[model samples]
Target: MRNVVLGFLGTQLDMGKRRRWRPSISLCQTEGFHVDRFELLYDRKFSRLAHDVRREIERVSPDTEVLLVQMDLDDPWDLQEVYAKLFDFAKDYGFDEDRERYHIHLTTGTHVAQICWFLLSESRHIPAALIQTGPPRGDEEIGTFDLIDLDLGRYDALQQRFDQQTREYGDLLKGGIETRNPAYNALIDRIEQVASISDAPILLMGESGTGKSELAQRIYELKLQRRRVKGRLVQVNCATLRGGGAIATLFGQRRSHTGQPGTERSGLLREADGGVLFLDEIDELGMEEQALLLHALETGRYYPLGSDSEVTSRFQVIAGASRDLATLVAEDRFRLDLLSRLNLWTFRLPALRDRTEDLEANLRFELARAEKILGTRVGFNADAADAWLRFARAPDTPWPGNFRDFGGAILRLCTLAPRGRITRAQVDEEVETLRRRWRMAENDPDARLVGEVTDLTLDPFDVPQLAHVIRICRTAPTISEAGRRLFAASRETRTSRNDADRLRKYLARFDLTWASLHDDT
Candidate 1:
């Protein structure tokens, strides 16, 4: 492979007395290094020096070809302009990495230019190693050169700083709460990286009250702080958008059809331009709206309702869904193309039950938030704290509503606490209240698993037992596991202890199957 060196012309150094060696010329004349081509970037004012350096390089290494790249920079010290010029040059340059090994000579350009080159090379925009050339010390005709392969992991200090910054980003996304869940921390870390680098649509999947909406807002704030986005974050709850006016609500209307005055609207998309558009409960969007949204996402332009001209709104999208969009697609309720577009950076936030270890941390966070809102500091006593922790981390806690439920529990505990100190009595009362609420929700046919899966009305006595059975089946890995849990006490009394068979028969009576319940879950 041929070696190609790219650098800027050092006008003052290369134009010095003929005896002194400059970066460009010295790079070409380095011992045991063969430069097949030297692509030298220079301002118009330094054209003469660029040519002189090219001549000297050609004289020292005749086999090397000289390509002068003229960059019109009014001020090389201007970082933005210099970087833009170099970026344009690299983008337009025909790079054949297979046949040519590229090197960026960092010794020739201005400090700003050198910084730009390093950034470009580090980002693989130029796909080259950095080379710094120096003048000869003594008795040597050629200068020395050092090749820097920009492997960031090799730099411990830099890697540590990067890791620290990443942790900070994650913390920012978590509202500065130091959660104890490893999976959750890792998820935040991945989200931090993606949010920093990409403007693609992000799909947040989780059950309701899993903090998807809060996390989406945090992501927008992160981008805003980093200057990745400029406009305000516009959030739309897709479930709330319904009826014939849904399109106009999202895409805006050109004018009032009823001849009413002052009905012009710019829409949420336009308001989100240059920022982030968060669509909470995106799976609830109508089919027509989904199609229009898919079109707007693919092309940053969309026509408003009753308008001939097209309007543009370039924005990053963060979509939150409580339901499985792929399942909706399979059911033909959601647009497959829209799901494809939004699924690029999908992240599923774990439910509160899945992250029980984070219960205490979230409890503290909620308490602090409550203090801010209520204007009074409130916390549980030692016994109450321990009781709350034990109940929260219990396997059967069943945090059906996740963080939303947890936050409500905290708020109520604070409100009921005497003199801002929640005692063991208050904790016991709150726990029982939570249990009663959960039990009621579970027994309510309209909200229970039995209601969701089957349309049949069952005996009042059978509903609660059947609902509990279905809930267990949904969470258990297999029919045998669920049956074992449900029939543990009774199995010893049975002559033939076939738990799975018994469970299957019970489910068959209700026209339900293990596979169907598991899938729905």
Candidate 2:
């Protein structure tokens, strides 16, 4: 396959005719490189010079295809702005179909333009190596050309160093997070990657019981070990921060007027000045509190109530929310600017229900913790473990409370453990408690109907089949209608049969009636 080169048309071509021979063409010929094509990205102001560049290139290498690409970077002097535009262009360009290997010529164009190309190539925005052309000076008057690998990320030693650092960071943060789920592990890896280096406000968003607070503490610990923060970890549930003294409590009170300032009473933020300040359930903060919090974060200094002097916290903020701040922002409840600040390193922890695959491991983890605390180890009996997991992770059970409920169930089972072992009997009671709690919490009509199935005790094994029948019964106008729909697929194979009677018999086995279900719904 042939190699293609992409680069900009240097404005140096604007010089006198005899003084300029396109360096890109000379570099290829001098270095004995046979490029199949050349893609020249140029500004409209350089169209005439670009044409000259193309003609000069083909004059030397007639077989080389020259493609003129017009770019709209009016002024390339602003490196940041030009880099952004070039980066966007590179992303939008289709690099996937490049069957032929390619090189980005870095010799032509202004130094800023060359750096832009280098940045693009370095980040793999373009799937090619970098080509640099040096002017001829010695015996080799044709100068020299060098092809540089753009895979700087894959530099053996550099990547290995990064890998080792990541592993160390992962171990530090992975202390209690024992799980084998890929997505969850990936989330952990990402958290480790960001938490170690970023001093920016970190926002953790998730439903209740997803371990946001736990993760926040872990992050604090990691940073503390690294000496990123020197003070203690100060945690406060934003929901609990209320009453008229909320400001005083969070920011401390200044001494009364008259005499010199009294002893400085440091608030939570000041206490966490050199460490991490964790605000859990931040969505619950009142607008006034939010304003104060935002001001402190934005300025790194907050005023104590009744004090004119601004106290410096220098605290790293880690905010947790159970609600979507974006939605709150749209509703004008949350400050958009504050959200933007915290969103710099935002990570959404997955809900427990979404991570059902890790249920068994996490359950065992809680049990182990219980054993450590109570000094009595307990293992779930095979049947009990199976039964407990089934009931807890069932789709019918709305784990709206997530890991909080799961942990509580573990605690209950440990307390109920007999002979250091959880028996099937204990699991049965715990499962029922969870089911009842979920039933009460849910307001869905279907769940409400299921809760009305008072006479029947549906175990884990019986849930799937029984739940379907219950749904069909609630939705169908009559038992006959329910039966036909319930067995719609199977009934097609039945030459002759009463679906209503079949469904009736099925419901009778479970001690449920169609009339009872429909009326309940």
Best by TM-score: 1
Per-model lDDT: 0.84, 0.76
lDDT of 1 by residue, 68-141 (tens): 98887899899999988888888988899889999998887789988999999878899999898777878987
The alpha-carbon deviation from the true structure for residue 344 of candidate 1, after best TM-score superposition, in angstroms, is 1.2
lDDT score of residue 5 within candidate 1: 88
RMSD versus native structure for model 2: 20.9
Query: What is the TM-score of candidate 2?
Result: 0.55
Residue pairs in collision within model 1: none
Tens-digit per-residue lDDT, 1-521, candidate 2: 78888887777743434334457667557545788888888889879878887888788788889999998786777798778888887878777544788788887777787788877777778778888776655566565677787464658878899798777777666555467778878888988867777788889998876888788888998787767788888887665455555676688876662244663456788888788999888887888988898889988898887688888878898999989999999999998888888898888888787888888778878988888878998898899999988887788776766777677678778877988899999988877776774665374444433443533445655655777777666544456777878888897788866999998788888767765553221
The TM-scores of all predictions, comma-separated, are 0.64, 0.55
Instruction: Please give the RMSD of candidate 1 to the true structure.
Output: 16.3
